[model samples]
Target chain A: MAAGEVSSLEDCLEEHLPPAVLQHVWRMLYGKDTRKLDLPKSALTASLEKDFQLKGFGFEAAIEQLRQPRVVRVGLIQNKILLPTDSPVSEQVAALQKRIADIVEVAAMCGVNIVCLQEAWTMPFAFCTREKLPWTEFAESAEDGQTTRFCQELARKYNLVIVSPILERDEFHGDTLWNTAVVISNSGKVLGKTRKNHIPRVGDFNESTYYMEGNTGHKVFQTQFGRIAVNICFGRHHPLNWLMYSINGAEIIFNPCATVGALSEPMWPIEARNAAIANHCFTCGINRVGTEHFKNEFTSADGQKAHHEFGHFYGSSYVAAPDGSRTPGLSRIEDGLLVAELDLNLCRQINDKWAFKMTGRYELYADELAEAVQPNFDPYIVTE
Target chain B: MAAGEVSSLEDCLEEHLPPAVLQHVWRMLYGKDTRKLDLPKSALTASLEKDFQLKGFGFEAAIEQLRQPRVVRVGLIQNKILLPTDSPVSEQVAALQKRIADIVEVAAMCGVNIVCLQEAWTMPFAFCTREKLPWTEFAESAEDGQTTRFCQELARKYNLVIVSPILERDEFHGDTLWNTAVVISNSGKVLGKTRKNHIPRVGDFNESTYYMEGNTGHKVFQTQFGRIAVNICFGRHHPLNWLMYSINGAEIIFNPCATVGALSEPMWPIEARNAAIANHCFTCGINRVGTEHFKNEFTSADGQKAHHEFGHFYGSSYVAAPDGSRTPGLSRIEDGLLVAELDLNLCRQINDKWAFKMTGRYELYADELAEAVQPNFDPYIVTE
Candidate 1:
């Protein structure tokens, strides 16, 4: 379980099981075990070469076997670190940072290699109320911020890919805040960040007030465990955003969401799960668990008794595999890590079985879209 | 088993079983010696209100006591009656009309009350090649057309709601076709038609060739069996299309798709199922089965030797309950009928367990969206 240690499925099975249960355990773990099934070598190699652009001598065959990577235990931190409205910014930051550190320690003990925190883990999502002061203090730079420092130290200590989403303060751009996801590598270095593309301006999720839509296109960051992508909350609703990440060689995507079932309860799980299945990527959705009360009350579409009392965060943090099989853990109520070990080979197996991307007719619609997006262009317009 | 005969669960169970196994059958069917499982009166009442929308009518409670509507049989039809390319227009019309009649006869034998066909079933999906002649010849008027007449007769003969989609040639507008779905009533009348709103012009699913974006918003048609809505293939990708349909009170939404996994295979079942779960509605997806060969060959986004050949349609037709429990029928290679008797009560059971619609924050993004879609009237402003 040490960092950079590579072991075959057979070796891991032998070492992990007792002599009496070894045969049965091996079959369950490696043999047609419903969850971690691998793809054909030829198909896997072609996909890796075509999608990932990985070119080296014997790299194709080597990565093909490795493509359906071994299942690694992943834990989701549904942290509900509430910062009092009246509390000073310094005190709030310190308290939240300490809470995250404690959660990491617990995750490490559980042998979790990848831990994903809920969206904007450092501060309570106060955007719904149009609070300006909270925005001023809560946002931090992805590279030098206190949040990055805490996550980097923890990642290095535990040898885990710490997915930390925060209201990123852009020091280069007039200190403007962007909804960003920072991937802290296992070696404590800051990997590249992906900004949220489709920002929500609907319901109690008034994300437009505090941060603008991200300009950076979809990107996948290479890590020790896998090439991962982060589609922060609202971006999950768009298929293209997920597609961009998938085509760019993202094996796993994390969707970290704040707020509750009240604002997007019906759409929860569905958005993230669909993104996973469509992209042929393993997706983990980490959501806040408790009912965090905000200082504002807002009316809903129909004049119902709707308030910004950050509706009950139905804590259904789940892991959806590439084949559409799901492990739904901890829903409605709070306080627990939802963990699942996903075999990367299923991605290739599913892609082969389904072959959606390969069969897709993109040429038919390309010209039409190019025409439609043009100003004052009408599809129905005939000659003269 | 006779049509129009609303057989009780007891009678159906008894008739389908042998006398030798009557004792075991009785316990399994009735769940008690008294021939009843006393369900909570509230559960029954809620089921009635939620499923049938029978306000203050305690019919469900009485039905539960009588064990009615528990195991109602249903059937789904996935078809591909390709429009004749070589034959005369009249010949093409006759051939397709005859095919529809044959399919209806098959459905009648199976005792299907609701038969949903693939999108634009009467004609081939010529949108991929932009062959204008096919569009002009195949597109029919929704009110009085060959397609409508066929559906109307089939509905009356079978005493069923024949949900048919057609390339609607709008007579009001000069040479305009709308992607329309016509719901034919059992009494040989057109109940309503829902036009597809979010038209996709991306890749090979070029729907814009024959039809324009639907101006009519999402609507739920109240039928004798249930309230239902129609969201055509491309429309499935948009979440708003689903919300609009659900908010307007659709209990079930039919997503009739033409494209298979090749173009966007991974997204097939995912989009529709998510919409159903998010809206707390029963969603059924019907897709065409088998491969289609078009008259043209086109390259994909990346320079791959692609063809305009209709990608192999992976027919994973499925029905998803409101509880997010999905029963996928056949895959791409199979051509068959999938039947399932859905307990309408499960809709209420799921909604009660996960009241997403009732609890979601719906109004927060109103202003932000309103601002985003606003037209820029500054005519003098120069672009890059």
Candidate 2:
């Protein structure tokens, strides 16, 4: 503050600051960088409107807000758990519990606000052979299940949202099992559940034996951190599912899958990435790694090895940006968490840059597609 | 022949047959069915060796002794021309006449083969800018220049292969120039070309003032009832470029393009589809999409667009098989023809059952790609 001496703060702002620099400044001024930036709701109402012009709009303001230094970090625990029939049920549950605990500890150390487990993470993928014992023993009720209690305890300890998927036994129905994903809040409360929509019975995998298609439409739950949507396995293939999640105001969508190899190995990433690109939302594809074998092998018509050797699961877990660029060097195998300091402003940046959502020919094929999905619908029959 | 008694020719060979039965068999043997049917070498080899287990290997023995087919139709065309420019007179002449005609008449269409024309079939794509005059004098080169004369004479006289692009001078390419395409057959007949690439310049529409990109590359040329490749303009964006042609080998590869899209667009199809799903033998891309412009606009950076609105040409035309999947698509649209046709049999059955080749890694990167062309390379690079 001497005469003829340039002030450091004034010099920094005047030296043609880059957007990143301005963002960091905004973060320093505001404790929470994204979504909590102090500004009038509209430009007309802003007190220092001229100074606020540099911030652009709400999404940009949110990104700048998030860039502020904060301790809350999140990581997802994506893994595949398969229980062989030969193993005792008690022993399998104990092993899974330990694994879950270890992953939660890792997340806590990384300061992750949430750690999402893969779909049906505790049970082995047993639908391949329609075996009765695996389904009967593995299915659990979300309300009173041992797995739910275990996850709740972990969430309380780590102070994190723990998303757990299970084979839920429906009490109201005729004891039918549902492919359900339960979201446990930081304070250890069951937020609610979403059943998977699409049930695939293609090739060797037959999921219909244990679980029916999810009836609940897409839902986004508001947590302390942000609004998030949970899409279970197989639902990722359908674009409409992602759209429904986006329309519900989800900023981030988590897709957890338990798919094994053969032709499917290549298609795993495509589903999640497409959802992100098309919806302009950040997407994480958490897949279960490793392999499992079933006691019985189904035979194909050609007498070939029909039951997949618990299909070789390639663990190419990744995080994709709204711009469709993925974090390279992500591990294809081995258990590790991939993290990136994402500038959330990129969501809108990409949206404005590509404008795919706005320009998309949504109405062109909407009617034709609706007819195709609905049952017994005939467009050719003109009822005037 | 007595009632309840059957006189069979095969029975005569097995048991002691009467002379009348043998003589009657001999008389029946000299019928039209006794002669073998002719088929293509690939079809016959595939049927007998793969399907029927035939033993003969030599073409003559397979045809005469084993009664297999030998004919396998193929076509080859070469293009050699530089994008037209108002510099280095000798080089321009060589490009227009000797070098280009040598490849077209001497190399490609000498035999009864299919041939393709280079991009811009006439002058260079120098109209990438706003300069007038150079493009204003465009003419029906297919009728006025040596290109048409050579093609007509070759097709009629030698029963040669021919496809030529010409500058159809009209109200379009400014006052007189029009981007045109012409397809010719072995009998020296014109098959007509479609004008429609519809070049859109986000930063520079210099092309609108000069000539338009052709609209169609969809038509299939037929000569001697055999299909041929006829991709003109920038018709590669449509996947139908390969799908329609590959439904049957049509037994040739021909791509003629003018330059001016993002550097990546031209290269994507040039390199990707050649190795696409099935490995077809003989694939070529001809280009006039190179650099050269007059001086209405100057003072731009070297290789930057001049006020005259033409760009400097990059001439790299290539012929490849399914083997080199990584070869970058040709860069620098120039005047050149790429010619090669090994055997249609090479692509036929191999790509039939194994759809993997056609499918390529489409699913792998399908969801991961945002804008096919990014202004900056930062997103695709691995920063870590």
Candidate 3:
């Protein structure tokens, strides 16, 4: 039958195909794929009964209610409000404000006590465009800005602790630009802000042109629901940024990001989860979705026309517990809100069991990094 | 029917059950399970096809032969040698030596150029026993001890760069003890060694009693295969330990560990993968399998009779590429050899694309950690 089939196909097309190629085609038709997939629990599980034993029991509901006073249901919003590059700054901000308010209302309905927006949630990620004046108009003072007032109103109305990340213009400090997250308490008080410590300089992320590295040290704000900290956008790429927040007593650390699918997709699922497990803290990584196209063509450092259309913002935001169990992520193509109940006691459970911080040789690393960061420092020479 | 069925089973057990208990059982039977799983792929996928795309593609074979000169196949050995706590040190060492030779021969057949064993591979993880005299007999000099000499012979025979981790007693340095990895070159030369920087204080890993923190600043050994670094066992818990190695130009960092399932199973799948992605380097996580039982029960710091049998080692050893694609892991309950052909240039490909090292804000972190590690430093002061 195989020989007959080859002859039958020969009438349809000339036998110009290589003999080896025909052999490969024949094998492809009859061979079973031997490439094994290695997904945990899901890809190769025989039954749900075996899967539960493999992953341990599901999250306990009885112990959860015992610690209800210490639990805060935190919400993360990954909103993708698309606007044209030539859209007015006011229109862009207004569109995001409207969309975020709707999403925050949904979060409130879902009983989220604390909510955080994406990095620079009020504006498009136009730093890649590299145009100074147009983007500068979107920056406002952290205090008494429209975004701050809006978040304060939401916090007061919903009795929620709202974290609003924004592009700030430090008017008192010579209009210095900063990537900042403003913490609004439930009582509408504008608490202190934590600036992003790390900035991106690779490919389309040319954020270094707009702001320098943060001068504000890692700070955990005391809120009514929980001790909260913000590691804005690019700061998620650095583990040290998250470590400092955990050291300063952050029960829940929110990484509000504006990264895209192709640029950070590979790393998006890994870094924050590792930080949550290693540092013994609950980490929420929120990223925006949808594609934002720029009208003006801008050149990257490598001279690529990076402003045509930024990559998809891939809004697969999720909450990772200290014990490494994570909530199902939000959608990758739509504006979504992910709410997770965080038990502050689980942090202590992980810390007491793993004791990474206790076993960590912090002093040695502190001294080494202090020296390693020096301009002339070099430590790779191996003496045999 | 739901109400009727509840009344039917309810006739017998409901009369004895407390109202709260009956309500809980009824809810448990009929309630929608809300414990959402956030695996990168589906919690339960239809096929392995969707899982592969979601996890990014596995190791690519098409990119192999183009740069044949830059490829080095490395193998990691995760051996679970269960020995009685009272066994003679010589007998245990001899047993591990025989089994390891067979595994190394298999690795050679698989074309591995560099090979590494699990942490302190020659003897049982007797730290859980906490009996000093019995385990101390297992310690040998790192220079030319029997373990080193054994590895040298294997390196010479197989033409392999072998990393042998053992409890090292530094006879020349006042008989000081350390957990060290001795690196042997292909021609049987002792290249160098790196001591375990971090030692666990929690659970069964009572290693601090035997050895203090290492003084060897993160050093990379220039080997015939690649520039290698060792972050033995507990060092895997600390991100800075890995960042230092990557900063020192280690293309491949081996984390040979003896951790167990209950204490670290969650973090096990995370830390090494994140280190590979964030640092733009290849990470090899090797953990021993099987359970090691102790005859003499030991007291934990919290005063529990903490010794009996340690948790399952769960030997899911894996190789995480710089692009964040991990090879399929080894068996969970068998002595295994995992060989992976690595493309050294992928490190640069990821680094150039991610630019984490360039954008890492080293100076700021150096200053911050330098202050944070001070003896008097306390950042968790709650004024309220």
Question: Which structure among the candidates has the greatest DockQ?
Answer: 3
**For model 3, what is the alpha-carbon lDDT of residue A148?**
94
- Candidate 3 C-alpha RMSD relative to the actual structure: 14.4
Candidate 3 per-residue lDDT over residues B160-266, each given as its tens digit: 99999999999989898889999999989899888998888887678887888887879999887788999998888789999999988998999999987656665
lDDT of 3: 0.73
RMSD of each: 14.1, 21.4, 14.4
TM-score of chain B of each: 0.76, 0.55, 0.81
Query: What is the model-wide C-alpha lDDT for candidate 2?
Result: 0.49
The list of candidate 1 runs beyond 4 A from truth reads A1-68, A296-308, A377-384, B1-115, B118-270, B275-384
Deviation in angstroms for A118 in model 3? 0.9
Error in Å for residue B59 of model 1:
19
lDDT of 1 by residue, B1-384 (tens): 012221122333344445545443332211223212233355345334322110110111113454356433344556554454545666766776765566555555545567777787776666777667744687888988878988888889888887888888888888688889988877778888888876765556666656777866566777766667888887776555665566666777888888754355545656787777767777778787656656566554445676756566656576766654555344444444455445666566556545554433332222222222335411111111
Please say which candidate is ahead in TM-score: 1 or 3: 3
TM-score of predicted structure 2: 0.52
- Highest TM-score among the candidates is held by which one? 3
| RMSD after Cα superposition, model 2 | 21.4
Q: Score residue B216 of candidate 1 by CA lDDT.
A: 63
Identify the leading candidate in terms of lDDT: 3
In candidate 2, stretches whose alpha carbon ends up further than 4 angstroms from where it belongs are: A1-74, A80-84, A142-144, A269-271, A300-302, A305-308, A329-333, A371-384, B1-384
lDDT of 2 at A311: 59
Error of 3 at A94 (Å): 2.2
Candidate 1 docking classification:
incorrect
